[model samples]
Target chain A: MNASTSQDRFCEELTALLPRLRRFARGLARDPADADDLCQQTVERALKSRQSWQDGTRLDAWVYRIMRNQWIDEVRARTRRSQTFTHEEEGANIGAPGDLAAENLVELGNVGRALARLPEEQREAVILVLVEGFAYKEAAEIIGVPQGTLTSRLGRGREALLRELGEIA
Target chain B: MTVSDDEFTAYVDGELTGAEAQRVAAAIAGDPALASRLEAQQRLRALLRGHLDPVAVEPVPESLTQMIAAAAAEDAERDMTDTKQHEPARVLDFAAARARRDDQVRAARPPRLTLPRWWGTGAAIAASLVLGLFFGMRVADDGASVTSGGALVASGMLAKGLDEKLASANEPGKLRILTSFRREDGNYCRVYDAGASSGIACKDAQGWILQRTVANGAPERGAYRQAGSAAGELMAAAQTMAIGEPLDAAQERAARREKWNK
Candidate 1:
């Protein structure tokens, strides 16, 4: 097939996966706008390195890897600028609590805030496994951790999340 | 026998297999404490999903779909360019080299000019032809466009501005054309940044149709992208609207002379 045909097919496949991509993005960035921006950047990066994406590998995992990297870079840049020194400060940057309250969606708003308060790695692990429902192996590969490491991070992340929600000991 | 945290975590994830999984399941059923721990893990997973999963189903913003489409267009252009550069070499070495070798063995016989297999497939020729058409629509330049009342209609100066303005040299005027191109529908489209607002316009039978406009606000010298100040955003919309690349100066001039092919 010609390049155009190949690219069109590739894009069609990728576009079908956008909703899941947005969900993962929302998990990473509490703010809706930021999540969309992150999704945009991920698509751009994946398209640029189209050849580097091996066929037969899961495209969702590849795109997730790109998004995770992009989010990490953004966080580091924000930190260097001292824009958000703590995770709570990061949640503040999202500025959704007031809006959530206005809409009477306080439970969701609190859950989102609590998720954001987890350390970055823990949050990533938890989001991939819990929110996105990637299998353990696939989640490990996307997060670039060994199976054991992924499970450990997930354990810590879930523990923290439950504690923050005041659900259990 | 008590399970370690790793085992418990793995069990929660369903990683344990065969007898081990069975063992964990039986243990949980027998021990209230173990069952409660398992329940907490499952609840936490469900709660997280309950909170954020709504974003998955919510209508994806138009900007995101546009962005993804724009990126795909770009990747196609890059791939076409790469193929154009390398395809000929492979053809010459494989087909031409074999033909030359055959001619040498036949002494004084004329060499058969055999085109590459892909040449017969018509992909290379089709690829080149499509490149110009694709890149014309794919490459991003500058400006943005939005509809005023959900439709892209324009008249008076906006149409006149597109017909006369040269993107290369900005005129100190209200409406400046950042770039122009032909849409796939054979209509002409222009992206314009008009001081406080930027938008895209396409020429139809009626005249320039305003596709989209962003209220960029007062052009601040230094600040976060004020509303839709990013001309690239407008250009992206133009690309989606366009059939091919923004016309070069020569093409633009010819287009103007023809009054945008109207």
Candidate 2:
């Protein structure tokens, strides 16, 4: 590792973001395999574009931007294929959540389960703002939405998640 | 003051400040329903964070992390004069495909040369360790590989390791398969560590052709790799020759079935 290089520093911080990246991916994709695949793409994209990232800026927002863009691309691709490709948990992923193998790894909490089942837009808002602790403006920027639109999605997502978790409880 | 749900959402998210925040504070204090709604968003935030924070801490797959570090490190290590010709960035750009190798493989310079049986199969230590020197297809009278018109051809144990060993099946033996990948033109290649030395070989035509060799010089292993390790240098060579991600065990097994053609 080039300890003194700025690239090294960038990667170090990027490595630190893995957990939250994984969590955000899981939230957005709603499938463990997809989440990991998303996470891998995000890291790859982030690294490839490491030069474009301005110094003294928040790496989290930059990475989240790359992640959501890749995911949006994936979601768009899946939407197109939804009619023809029966797209069950992709062919090679070991286990999707709720599968016995994944269940054995960690028995997911009820709130986590409810969050996973939320609608895509709402899930994105919830994960960015609530789960990732990003401010509304930052979350909006990451999602490429206006603050007003972001708040609306957050409100709807929050209400649905509350209702869903209430049932799970 | 009846705070709209959007205003309440912003307030809960800590985005509403000063007058609007104060207004929400007063409303929540006076109305149990408002207070409960406020508490619900806060609870959800906590719940969501609680649920997701653990994933960030979970062991990041080594491949993902290493990809970033090694790519950057190699980018720094590469000589400026090497090649200005650039290939498009690919997610599968995991091989050490230097331009020369790509050109050599593309032109199909020579008919496939057969490796001599005298090259010695099985766990033979690479009799020499030429660390830090890229002896381009430098053939030995009695070596694991020989060059035919500058392209390194794998013979002996190196050839056997490239043919049979899989990195996924990491058994401690004399031959250690580090990784396998395909080049841009679609030939399969592998990096290996055998006793004292390691090198990379790409399967061209009908057999494993050694592309480059150094004394255990495989770079770009992972970012955590110590700088200038001979093992890393070998991988660095492999990286320039590859335009695809390393073959996982299944892909490697599949490649083997096809004898690594194309």
Candidate 3:
């Protein structure tokens, strides 16, 4: 395909990946608005640098990596400005009322708060492997870590989440 | 021998293969503690997935889609520039060349009001009333209709344009209809943008009541940013008002034909 056609096709495919990317971002960022912003930044960056993306590799992985790096950059920038990344009030307001019962909603809220409490590294690993369904190797590649590191993070993350959800003592 | 936490995690994740996975399974079968731990891990994973997977299927926000479209348009423009650099030029008559240049300039410029015939009486009265009530005598030239009290208010052509036009018509400089949806109260609301400003208006007896308008700095004439900070209020308004998924093109067409009746 010609350059423009290829880019158009790439964007079309990228659009299909948006929800998954946004979910991953939600795991990484503390608030829904921030996560959406991160997702938008990743998409914009990915489109601007489409020439650099290889044609055959997993586009989802590539986009995930972009989101990961974007989040890191945002955190660094926020740190330099001495601003807090997690907005407790904003994060609290982020949850929309769903079709679930009040008890299930509370449970979901607990799970969300628990997920948000995990260390950033552990959260990243859990989201990639457990949520996004990435293999250890694929998740590691997206997070720029070794397979062993990813596995360890997932293990620790699982334990923490289990404890928080009262699934374990 | 006990299976390590990493091994258990790997097995649960379906990453273990052959003898490794078999060995873990056998260990779990033999050791009750290991079995319980494995069960806990599995449960936790499942529970997290259950709680979070909904986000993945949540309706993709319109602002994000607009952002992606804007980026793609920028990419296309860059591609056009690159192609122009490599292509051969064609000679044309002076008038034709000038006309082509004018068209290009016009395309680059933001949408301007063409003053449709109905504007003379209808829009003129609405515009004067809204402007006088909101901005008093001296209106701001920021392309945003706002009140003297520093609130965004839609009036005149902007309000009328959003009411009468279908997004499919694709008029330049006109209010671009971003999306439409019915509110919980059964009123129809639309997200719209002019050259620079964007807001949400819900139809009522008063005619396209301006629910909320945002006056961020004007984006470049033809270049709209979907996720601009200016849209934050409008987005929040849309999120709060939208009862369900915004209507698709066909639904939007039908709604327009019905003159946005409930």
- Which candidate gets the maximum TM-score versus the true structure? 1
Docking class of 1: acceptable
Identify the runs in model 3 with alpha carbons over 4 angstroms from their true place. A1-5, A83-108, B70-262
Please give the lDDT score for candidate 1: 0.68
Superposed Cα deviation of residue B74, candidate 2 (Å): 2.3
Q: Pick the candidate with the highest DockQ.
A: 1
- Root-mean-square deviation of each candidate, in angstroms? 19.1, 14.8, 20.0
lDDT of 2 by residue, B72-167 (tens): 665554421112123244213313433433443334322332111111101001112122122222222222332224676778877877788877
RMSD of 2: 14.8
Q: Which one wins on lDDT?
A: 1
> How large is the interface RMSD of candidate 3?
2.1
Off by over 4 Å in 1: A1-6, A83-108, B73-262
Comparing 1 and 2 on DockQ, the stronger one: 1
Against the native chain B, each candidate's TM-score is 0.42, 0.40, 0.39
lDDT of 3 by residue, B62-112 (tens): 877787787677668666445434444422443454465445434532344
Give lDDT for model 3: 0.67
DockQ, computed on Cα atoms, for candidate 1: 0.37
Q: Give the per-residue lDDT of model 3 (tens digit) for A1-169.
A: 3778877878878988888888888778756777888988898888778788888789999999999998988876754443354466654443421122345335547777787667778888988888889999999999898888888898788778887887432
lDDT of 1 by residue, B1-262 (tens): 7777777778887778999988888888989999988888888778788888888889877876786698776766566445545766677654765465444423422233121122211222222222222222222233243347666666677767887997655366776676777788788777775645667788877777777787653334321234322453565456566663456555677788988874
**TM-score winner between candidates 1 and 3:** 1
